[model samples]
Target: MEGKSWIFKNRPAIVASGVVGGPFEQKSPYSGEFDLVKDTLWMEEESFEKANRQLIESAIQVTLDKKTLSSNDIDALLMGDLINQITPTSMAARTLSAPYLGLFSACATSMEGLALSAALIDGGYCQKVLTGASSHNAAVEKQFRYPTEYGGQKPPTAQWTVTGAGVALIEKASPHNAPLALIEKATIGKVVDNGIKDPFNMGAAMAPAAADVIERHLNQTNQTIDDFDLIITGDLSRIGHPITEDLLKQKGIAFKSGQFLDCGKMFYPELPDVQAGASGPACSAMLVYSHFLNELQKGSVRKILSVATGALLSPLTFQQGESIPCIAHAVELSSPAVNSQSFRGEE
Candidate 1:
């Protein structure tokens, strides 16, 4: 059977209740302005399970406040995170009263959840879906990169894992609710391995996968880079972003210099000094919640295509001589001009 379309032509109604959590008071390798490298609010636990629980609880609180929703009111909770067996997300869901669905797309998990929830609402599956993703700096480091205490010097292209979470409530399109943005079109990525095997060099490993999706998205939608105000790449970092662009140019596609931005670059630009860029699930989530969502609300930018990229590889698999498998999911965001009228009346 053909895959279902994740993009919405009529534009779905979604509100990012806002994000909660940061690398505060956590025992981590980073310090200073970029000290919050843990990318999460929970640092009280040494075990991944405990940290995951804390992260989920924080996300749930944010969702409740933003939507004015109680745990019993939500139809379903769709969540994911980067961890073995997705333990963090699973544990967090156990505390919630809403039915839960777990997903795994590495870094792209947030976008994937948003896309699927939008599709479900669009198909009349239900209304009021909550989707979120989180990442812990310590756990990710221990699993993928070196130990948090290793203190090894990173390459220029390496991206710091953000310790953060983002939650968005997706509802049926309506005339009243804020029309945050819709998934206009999406080009799902196939697993691509170019034989680059360094776990630390994720940018290089995932660049080809990013290039493939960019090519296919433009081709399938018949939209060029200029069609949208911005073409944002999730967590590819500085190094992978350029590599993806260079490869795209070779394929006869070109994006304006300022037109392209990386979520990794937007976070921790002053600290961590990531030569290449930022990586991790929180990298993209924080960028979307903190930067893009704010811009859409303020009418700074009307249309945007945010693509979250992921390197779908485990340390065990990489150690077993497996090449990196990467994927990306694209979501479009637009301003809610129609809903703003309601706010005007209240003012």
Candidate 2:
């Protein structure tokens, strides 16, 4: 059977899940699990280094429980984050028992991790793989813009960096496992730098990159806009979302507004007081791990193509008057069958 056929046949299941350290959980209006804020974990300080370590440990514990395997069972660990040279990920991986491979795609790091882990399992390079991403609001703010206490009012196109992390365990196919929807295809983004220089205007910087990847993904997969149940963009906020739709439509691909969603928008509707939308690796990661993952498990939605978008610009580059280079990574997820067995177990 062909690679795609094998993917569609032996669906991979996300047997376990975990999230560590975030400031969102402690903040106002987001304090309860039933409440959107409660559903997310958050950290208080600007310590991404600390948050990254917690995230990896939490994910490893969850994976161990779900797969009935230990850290030694994992053949490899793949991770990424929005920190410098992905320092948070690399440093966190040092403590893990599994071998590690660092990756980066800005906000798209988590989906990138998933895609790579799926490939490793499908290619028989590994049996069990762990993948995840983390980001802290304080660290990102200080690194990309001003400090959290800078007290600057942001423009409508600006986004709030989320202080959180999410991790998932991808394992080999087994008769006792539920079909954890496999990654049918991935559309790795090419760097799209159109010379948009404003650091505050990330929507303008990233819109084209999102459009480019979406187009390329559809073209490569031979799938139309209607092929998947949902087409989710990472952090395109209100500004970039419309532009992405326009660009895709210009390419003759039409996706319904209901079918199209943004993780930024989902993160906090009440925080509309927030400008461009929610951002940072954790913004999208939390939404996917908590909201979308649950929907998939309950069979509310079947197939989804999630694209995590990022603006590859730093405070230094922007200060140096360089344009923002943008990229996105796309991952596909599907619902497991009703008769499948759950992988939930004690750690």
Candidate 3:
């Protein structure tokens, strides 16, 4: 494939999606777009990790319900989260009883699943695959930083982990079913460590990796900045978003501010105490599956390049004074209307 980028010949279609969020996410500007919103993180579970698993299960249920399908209809389930060893996702898989593959890419887990789902469908390996990612604020905070109960203070660079889950039901394109969007291409990023060790400032550490993938995706796919209606990043927030823009310009690819946006910065514009906006596997998944897909369905936007970034460092690695290694995966999507036509980058 051209330097970690692959063009999906079959153009796997995203048929349906479901997003669930907690009380913290209810305040998000796009909260109404979510299929379900729980008033508390617990969701009647005894622990936050259990609650995280509940979120994933709920999201999967919502996705299946939207398409009027059951877990038995799903050929495979791919998902992950930020918890240790991604136990929450595995437990959810256990409940679903579907052939499952648990993934781990820190916050970038969502697009990683989506990319592989498209590849599998394009290659004729599977028919229908359920892929997604989830995260819990309290669960992740307790593992990465201090528990919310401890009232630990954070710097302005620290981002608030989102409490949410998002899943998508993807399958081979069919004349019988209309698609929400078509997965056109995918670019897998290389690991990039900027020598930053602070767990709080994840945006800075992930910015370079995001830029690297975006540049590679554009160049390898023979596209330009103008090819996409939007190029959105997973988190990166207020601090890292600008850093990514600057880095892209240095690489001979520049775009206007409106052309590029970050899910973290847009998720909680009016909310308070989110110093650097949202950061979690759910951040990008929730946004793309809900808002951006809805926009495509409404014909407001036709094409998008979504880059979900991840910090590969675990608590042990950071605690041991290791710099964070970051990565990003880019997935190009086109509206169903555009999918009917012969479309490619600038001739």
What TM-score would each prediction reach against the true structure? Answer: 0.87, 0.86, 0.97
Whole-structure CA lDDT of model 2: 0.71
lDDT of 2 by residue, 128-190 (tens): 788877777767776777777878787777888776667777765555555445455676777
Clashing residue pairs found in predicted model 1: 7-183, 38-163, 39-162, 39-163, 39-164, 40-163, 156-276, 238-276
Candidate 2 stretches with Cα past 4 Å from truth are: 1-11, 25-48, 338-347
lDDT of candidates 1 onward, in order:
0.72, 0.71, 0.91
Task: Order candidates by TM-score, high to low.
Answer: 3, 1, 2
Clash pairs detected, candidate 3: none
Off by over 4 Å in 1: 1-5, 24-42, 46-48, 272-275, 338-347
The residue ranges of model 3 lying beyond 4 angstroms of the native Cα positions read 342-347
Worst 10 residues of 1 by lDDT: 27-36
Greater TM-score among 1 and 2 belongs to 1
lDDT of 3 by residue, 1-347 (tens): 55758899878889899999999899998999999999998899999999999999999999999888988999999899999989999999999999999899999999999999999988888989999999999999899888899998899999989999999999887766578888989999899999998888999999999999999999999899999999999999999999999999998888966999999999999766999989999999999999999987666888999999999998899778899999999999988875664233211
